[model samples]
Target chain A: MLNHIWLALIVIGILTAAGRDIHEVSQNSYGNGIPWMLQIESPQTISVYGEAVETSLRVPRRQLQLHFHETAAADAVIPARVNLTHAREGVAVLDVTGDVPQQFKIMAEALGSGETLTARLRHRGSGWEAEFDPVSLVYLKKVTNAAFDIAGVAVQIAIGLIGIMALWLGVMKVAEKAGLITSLARIVRPITVRLFPDVPADHPAVGSMIMNISANMLGLGNAATPFGLKAMEELDELNTKKGVATDSMVTFLALNTSCITLIPATAIAVRAAAGSSDPAIIIGTSFLASLTATIFAVTISKLLARVKMFRWDRSEAE
Target chain B: MEIFRTFVSLLSAIAIPALILFFLVYAAFRRVKVYEVAVEGAKEGFDIAVRIIPYLVLMLVSIAIFRASGAMDVFIAIVRPLTDLVGIPAEVLPMAIMRPLSGSGSLGIMTETMQAYGTDSFIGVLVSTLFGSTETTFYVLAVYFGAVGIRNTRHALPTGLLADFIAFLAAVFFVGVLL
Candidate 1:
């Protein structure tokens, strides 16, 4: 199912890009000039003509055109000597002089400084004029570029997970062997009993349920899967309805869905790999969110079980 | 507020290492062959990671394609008004929607979000919190329940959806306060 959807998306992306490319061909401005949308992600100091000034720039400036009248104020064009540099693939780099600092400040302020800003540029005699925040230009770039981006990210992620997953799983193994899991399960025994009243406290399902929840809380996804499956199978053994789910089954699913995760290690690792300054910062917020979700899942499942629409018929006991 | 943020940061810094230390010491006291068990567990972990790669790749690729085709942008635009009312940023709508459907998909989206917004940015933090807190409700249901041949899922779908909804709101709230 997913494979088909993926294929469809690829086809659609190619078609869309092709259609746009065709329209672009028809417009055929080439060197003659057409309106250009400049997307500036951030502003920083860049070397332009042996001088440094804060500006929005991309290197190798062949197509680089500077007319501040678009995203910047109508009168914000600075009277500076434009020094052009190399440009590649329709991107350019350029250095400008004259009241550039003041002009750049005005444009930067209008561009919101820290966020992505888009400006419109159109032919005006030998130069161009630009406008701000034209929303129509926002679209995902080339599908090939996105595919490359995802491929790099996926491999990076898979590699990153290896060490951390190994470390935590190894510790978990020790804990399990030491009977730590059972001890941890004991702490949540009362709640599990109430949730799965049909299953005996000593049943394997109960132990598996506790272990599954604990693994999830510790952000152990791979460890959680087997235990969760085990619990489901164990719970299934006691089910009188062969193909139908029991109340305990539904409740267990709900609980598993909202299990509290204490450390978002995977998320943090991805962030860290992406060069986040503080990778662990999301942990606290994640904990709070997971805790709330768990409360809601457990409570809502219990409440929904009592509703007539969801109540199981005990009269059809096998 | 600054102090609180610092405290939270310190708490996270210490939590995992502390937990590992406590487990090691406790296992030692119990006289479980610690090194052997750890190695064995690590092997299992390795196997699980290997097993998940195909699924991860498929999900990630699908997400990449969906997003690259501008479908995600359209989806976000459509839901922006409703999300705005609930304080969920438009930036995180993909993560929120994908969370309950597929784990790898949500993780991929979160990675993309972090890359786009900068990991420390508010939107990045919000998406990460949402990604970490929620489960792949539909995937879990299909995999586990289907494995047992339970054709009737009863209230699991609704309950899971409810949980995901609460998780989305909670993430927005917690990130707002703490991050």
Candidate 2:
């Protein structure tokens, strides 16, 4: 399944890039008009002008580059604001000064289309002002971005995973050693038995499955993966047909895949790192959402098990 | 309602410590040799982490390719009209699709969205709630089922997708009412 999905992404990326480049070859110019949103706090008159350039089509594609020149009297206290806006899309606000005129480059998607770009300005606490004239910006068809992004993002994520996985795995070890997992398994045994009717309550697979789900709920990601693997291996031991997923396996897999997470520690950490005012605000809503999802996942798997097409055929596996 | 809110907050504050303490206390009472067992289990962590790296990297890279190729944008544009009617914001469509595919990719997208839109905005809450609620279904399937060598996944995929769909809707609904 994943193999096909990966192949599709690469193929679509290459095709889209080739198609767009083909169209670009016929066009006279790759530049699009972008409107600027300017704001100044000082009383002195100010004028700003700029053009966008296409820097590179290689890995880490630099889609657009903007060079803007502003002529204004220097003031230490007064604030200067420059922002790009699209009608339906959001705004990207930048603070600029005449002292150091740095070029700006942003993702092409963030700036919207070439035609609809608008610049709005606000002066000295006045309402937002707009310029009808749009700045000419160049566009590029980045066909290889996906390929590069895949490689780049993989390295980035792998680096992040190393440390996080180590920490969580250590904590999980402590929990498992302390007999917390078995205690947790015992507590949730009733629910687990009801969910997986085929699995004997006393079977070690049941305990492992509960531990996996518990680890998931506690947001012990690394721990959960191992427990899940162990659970599957144990469950497979009882399977009548090797290589064919039994009803119990399907149920367990669905529940593990859609389990409700009580503490979304990773999300909270990311939000807090980004300077969110209240990182934990999503907790209650997220719990409710996960609960809904788990219920649906369990119900759907059970319902689907009854369907003739989805039913397991022991002979087919052979 | 206010009291319930306080209770949740209090619980959240103590949840982690409580869990840790419960384990320690239980093992101590049972004379389970906590320190030795903890060390023995911790030893397995290094190997498990190593084992998962290839699968994790594979999923992450594929997701990056999907996002960078602009196919996701094209797909989103096609679905916008239909999803708009369902109140699924266009801003969150990337997240909904990627949530099942890759954990890191979706996290990056969520962070980017929160940066673009203020963290307090509607989209921010919706995505954050989504990130909190949903699991990386495909990753789970590949790692767990693949470990057991189960080729005939049967109803697992559909069941997982159904759960994700419910999670998406629930995120929107609960955030709408609560936030």
- On lDDT, the candidate that comes out on top is 1
Candidate 1 residue A65 Cα shift, in angstroms, is 17
Each model's lDDT comes to: 0.65, 0.64
Question: What's the C-alpha lDDT at position A43 in model 2?
Answer: 21
lDDT of 2 by residue, B1-179 (tens): 34644564466566557755776677778777767765665565455445555665565555555555556777888999999998778999999988997777799889999999978788998998898898888777766665566666777777888889889988999999986
Q: Which candidate achieves the best TM-score against the true structure?
A: 2
TM-score of each: 0.55, 0.65
Over B68-130, each residue of candidate 1 has an lDDT whose tens digit, in order, gives 556655567788998788666787888887787556778888889888998889998888888
Model 1, runs deviating above 4 Å: A1-188, A314-318, B1-72
Q: Score candidate 1 by lDDT.
A: 0.65
Q: Candidate 1 has what TM-score?
A: 0.55
